[model samples]
Target: MPTDTQILAAIDAAFGDSPRPEHFTHYRHCCECAEHDELLRHRDRETLQHADVGNAGWDPICFCSPEGIAYYFPALARFALAEPVPELDWYGWQMVFHLDYGGAENPFFQHCAPQQRQAVAGLLAHLLETRTGLLEMDADSALRAHGVWAG
Candidate 1:
């Protein structure tokens, strides 16, 4: 397993140049939500590193545009690498890997460039190896059931 620092380095290499979006949320209905408001507070900022994404919660990530999700992924990954809990569900990391065509694909995971996909795969593999309890998942079953294979 790669060290956390190495995993983060891979993330930076893959996603560092992704542009920030004007609005982080895709749907207008989400615009009225408190989480959306929080995300908006960082819209004018150059980087989201200081944004409290965990406070904004997972809904924004689930509904955001491809650019929006890419912009936030580094911060999201950082949060997951922290002391994650099952209830927080790794801040919706699984949502990105879920293969359901019935409105379940994360725009970032679905439309990301190949390099981005590899970076995500590395991150997921690292998480599964070191944080199984925090992820609250069986590796093989998750890969089989959710189409979340990284190998």
Candidate 2:
């Protein structure tokens, strides 16, 4: 897997220089986002403690809050492992996509056009592929390379 720094860099690159302030605010708190300042503080944890605050049926484990979903889905979609993508089951995914593409519930929608939304989706898909490739490697070596595991 990419190091947390690498992941955050990727997210920043994906969002580019023109990210809206509201989007940046939401992204900073999203659990799935490595750029989330809170995540950086809890780097030793294997997973998020309360990821599903906004989930409808199943409880999520990270930033599962509505805001989390709205801000993180694009990034998460890139790393989803299951075929057809797991976000399909989460209402937050739809909401985020709609908002990013043109839906008005979020102020970020004011800054994003369909093209930018599509670009974000594509970048997220690439990040997911990179995450999957990293997962396919042996854990010990991968973790060592990222300097995230000592054991």
Highest lDDT model number: 1
The stretch of ten residues in a row with the least summed lDDT in candidate 2 is 142-151
By TM-score, the best candidate is: 1
- Write candidate 1's Cα lDDT for 20-127 as tens digits: 766666445644454664665555324553234443344445556677667666776676677655444454344334422233254455677878877877877677
Candidate 2 versus the native: TM-score? 0.29
- lDDT tens string, model 2, 1-151? 4444454455445444432223322445445453443442342122433232224333332322334333443344332322333444433233233333323443443444555444444444433345445344333333322221111
Instruction: Give me the runs in candidate 2 sitting further than 4 Å from their true place.
Output: 1-13, 16-54, 57-74, 79-105, 111-115, 121-151
Q: Candidate 2: which pairs clash?
A: 51-61, 51-62, 51-64, 52-60, 54-64, 78-128, 79-128
lDDT of 2 at 53: 23
Clashes of 2: 7
Per-model C-alpha lDDT, please?
Answer: 0.59, 0.37
The C-alpha stretches of model 1 lying farther than 4 A from their native spots are 30-38, 41-52, 55-58, 85-105, 137-151
Query: What are the candidates' C-alpha RMSDs?
Result: 4.4, 13.8
Against the true structure, what is each candidate's TM-score? 0.70, 0.29
